[model samples]
Target: MAFRVREFELALMHRMQDLNAGKVEEALHGMSASRAELRAAHAHWTRLAHAPRAPKGAAALRMALGAPPYRGSRPAGSLTCDVLRWPLPSWPGLAFEALLGPGGEVWNQWFVRPEGPMTVAFTDLTPWACVVGDLGASFPGAVQIEGPAPHHWTVDFPHDGRTYRARFVYGLIQRLE
Candidate 1:
């Protein structure tokens, strides 16, 4: 039970205020808005709840400036090498294909190694970027992004170098389902 994507856009703004207080279904696009356009889409879902995750040369120009994409399904569970920052060949990396979803693969894959002296801190609960793992390799796992809601990403390998950390604290549930 994981959920994010701004908690399903704030549960679709409380199901659009319980379907405008009358509550019913069947409105695939019958759409209705006002109350100042649902308070500006509820302030764009509270600015996507503190959206961040763009470092290292600006994640490809902040994902081409309109990033809100992720959509590869059928992955209910499996793949959790307990945060896979494996011995990845003692570090000499290059696995960058961040963001695709919307039915494509790679909803995030930034294994940008080369801090050559060990230091990696890719925290999600909101420390977006920190790389300096000075090259030893242990970079681990994290991949869950099927949004409209529910987002996650992890890639670490602290080299046991005595100074590598991780932290992610938005809704909680880093992995292990």
Candidate 2:
């Protein structure tokens, strides 16, 4: 999932660069607000690039929870993935998303569609919560509480067109560097 998202990021970067360079005009004319959200996502990925990679799944999970075993061989299971969109002002504020789960557990589903109304939703999710954080900040986002079982938690922002849909699913490594 992270791999795919990386590709998405690259595309977004290219698009943003084109827009900035005046190589590609935007359909929405002024999308500076949307661009800001993309910027946040870009910054978040830049930070993760410097973070130690967990060579094992266990290490990935541990790292997700922000635990010990500070440094050494990277664990395989402890991988963190961020698949978030830049929030539109007409919609909602920007959001930072992180998925932390066991290495083998895959969280696969799209939450929004490109050219459609923007919305956020989570389903068949466990750990009962998701943590949001700012760009490159060690401190995490508000610890959102979840209901029992795989519940569909969603947030609706303003929209002009039809409904948007995107899905994402990935695992978190359990160990640290």
lDDT of 2 by residue, 44-64 (tens): 545554567633333333333
Give TM per candidate. 0.21, 0.21
RMSD of each predicted structure:
16.4, 15.9
Whole-model lDDT per candidate: 0.31, 0.29
Root-mean-square deviation of Cα positions for candidate 2 versus the true structure, in angstroms: 15.9
Worst 10 residues of 1 by lDDT: 81-90
Residue-pair clashes per prediction, in order, are: 24, 46
